[model samples]
Target: MERGTRSVVRDRDVCRRHGVVGVLVEPRSQARCAVVVLGGAEGGLHEADAVALAQEGFAALALAYFGSPGVPSSLVDIPLEYVFRALDLLSARGYASGSIGLLGGSRGGELALLVGSHDERVGSVVSVVGSGVVTAGIDYAAGRLDRILATSGAAWTVAGRRLPHLPYVVPPELVRSIERDEPVSLRDAFAALPTGDELEAISIPVERVRGGVLMVSAGDDGSWDCVGLSEVAAGRLRAADHPYPWAHVVLEGVGHTIAGPPGGPVAPYGPGPGVTFRYGGDPVLTADARAETWRRTVGFLRYTLPRETADEA
Candidate 1:
């Protein structure tokens, strides 16, 4: 199957566990069935992006773990176990065999790593601005609060909008729970989350995983320390002596989100300090970078995905 627009299932219940729902999207062709899980923090799938993947010959499934009000969309809210449940559901549906691959960004990136680490079914993964383990050094929650306060106080502009102060604080109750380790602390859970250790601890048959990974990062992802997360993940991969084919690319002058070059169609930024160059909502790259990265990602997938090898260009 080649690139073509076709209908695929969307927003359908794939599975449920612990009051969380796993939504699925099924691609048209059975020749290759691959699911791309979205980051809970980013909400739902962009209809355009979903369609694009289907056209590219993938059974792209955007699993929604959060985004529902009060359900906890932040990395802290959802447990790594939820991602595993989504993977399991797809496996039961016969989505793919040998190993499953997952894609995630921001907080979702962390979740993807968690799933790929513990679940043997995960074939490969692409984590955009994600971390291998959640540790106390990051202080993500506090960092988020600090950034919000700083942005509020700074003089910034975006698309003519004045800098905005984002005064947000985690609910006190949630904070209390985290401190008490009631149930399980998010940081503790994340640090303890299985995946980044030696392959023995990781369920995926890494050597068999063809594409391995594509880790991408930006200069200023929305998070307080996106760079730290990226670095930590990269370090883990190296420490583990990962043998699978993998590449890590950190784009300069870009934020957590992908954006086009600064002068051309500048990506929309929120009104806040550093907002002018903070996050990106558009694709950014020189023709060469764009072409090369695209080629690499496609080639990597083609080499890794079992179906792609059988269908050789």
Candidate 2:
């Protein structure tokens, strides 16, 4: 698609030579910056969002860490190195390490913050409805259902070692509901987790991030306590006196799924069949929040990772 003088181009084979599963989108003209886009527990390449960013004159890569042919089958113990490979690919495309940003939503949001904290190359981050601490992964296989029903395993790893994580405490009723394939809200399970000094050990250590951070959450998130988690990250940044700009935004009356890009269908929240999840927010309000969140995200990225001027380009 044409965007003023620059036309958008997509390269599905952009990272294939490096054994990375992703699609790269950018303007035919030199891009201003680069961003790595990640999806949540739904697990897939977020190509649409990447294309949207590309239309705005940035090089965007929609990476798939799981639920793809070449990656892990599920969300368990995904290696951070996999993401680094994507960064390396972007770097090879002439984007400086300092010009790269990470954007993610829900579980992907948590992954983005965690990655930014570990990698100095990341210049900016936008985490939507993500967590401030490491949390257990989800395994859907019937044989491993017991493990998932309890604490399960860590969602991420580095150098083949699992990171410390908080475990979910599922109640008996919720377990029964899951067994019966009934619609269930996992919010109660998350609320049942202990809130104490123990959490400090598993915290994301946001102070280590080398660039600006923007944490976005919904006030009425039914999937988990996103607002509280975002606060935890923001508080850490403030306490460290982070040199880069940082802000936390809370969209009231919206739920866990509040990061949709603009110009898309704003469908009402309605769970379809067995084991459906509820996000908790008015349909109209959630639609509004999605649009607002996208605007804020774009503005934040522009501030933190500004595009090159005409002379530089």
lDDT of 1 by residue, 1-313 (tens): 2233466555443444323454455566553656555553445443344444555666566566554443443333345565666666766666555445677666566556656655666767776666543322212233433343322221112234332221234455534543454331122112123333432332222223233766666554444344555565666566667777776787655544441112222343433221222344234543234344334545555556666422342
> What is every candidate's alpha-carbon RMSD to the true fold?
12.0, 3.1
How well does candidate 2 match the true structure, expressed as C-alpha RMSD? 3.1
Q: Give the Cα-based TM-score of candidate 1 against the true structure.
A: 0.61
Please provide, for model 2 over 57-108, each residue's C-alpha lDDT reduced to its tens digit, 9 standing for 90 to 100.
7889999999888888778989999999898998888787668999999888
Query: How well does each candidate superpose onto the true structure, as a TM-score?
Result: 0.61, 0.91
Worst 10 residues of 1 by lDDT: 183-192
Question: Best candidate per TM-score, number?
Answer: 2
Each model's number of backbone clashes? 13, 0
